[model samples]
Target: MNKFLEQALLFDFYGELLTDHQKEIYEQFALEDLSLSEIAEMKGISRQGVHDLVKRCQKTLEGYEMKLHLVEKFLSVKEKVSKIDDTLAEWECEKNDPEEMVKRIRKIADAIIEEL
Candidate 1:
């Protein structure tokens, strides 16, 4: 994934684990795209303080992602589903071997169940 999307996903997944104040500031600045000065003015903090808080929150979110690998697991499941879809499409085009297609479908179902 691209850097921005990766960061966004990590922020979304790990953000709830943050402190309430951290969540508020992070949501406003990171997700809402507020400028530091604007956030500082809203929160009654210095711009430098807001900047530092955002940095700390970012580091904390990254730490969770690195340690837990929740995002990695989710991405792996998504890739498997995509591969299954491609295989089904190929089977449909080739119009050959219902047995193999059934087996593939079964495997996909099993994999999705395991993911769930």
Candidate 2:
């Protein structure tokens, strides 16, 4: 996965676990895509301070991902579901053995939903 997407998933998975201050800064910097300087100007902090806050928040989020693997599991299931959808779409137009493909896709989709 792309770095930004990975960070975003991790952030969403872990942001709620952060302190209020940490959540504020993280939401601005990661979720809202604010520049460090921009956030610092709004928060009355130095750019370096804002940078450090973001870095700390990143580390915290990554720690959660490392220990819990919630984001990783969610992403894996999502990918599986997408692949299943693709297979189902292909099976719709397939000329031979479409039932097996459809069954496989249904099973994957069911498993993904169960995980969710």
Candidate 1 wrongly placed segments (more than 4 Å): 105-116
lDDT, each prediction? 0.88, 0.86
Please provide, for model 2 over 1-116, each residue's C-alpha lDDT reduced to its tens digit, 9 standing for 90 to 100: 78788778887788888899989988888878899999999999999998998899899999988899998788789789789878877877775697789788788978888887
Q: What stretches of model 2 exceed 4 Å from their correct place?
A: 106-116
lDDT of 2 at 40: 95
lDDT of 1 by residue, 8-58 (tens): 788888888999999999888877889999999999999999999999998
Q: Give the range where candidate 2 is weakest over 10 consecutive residues by summed lDDT.
A: 87-96
What TM-score quantifies how close candidate 2 is to the native fold? 0.85
CA-only RMSD, every prediction: 2.5, 2.2
Model 2 alpha-carbon miss at residue 59, Å: 0.6
* True-structure lDDT of candidate 1: 0.88
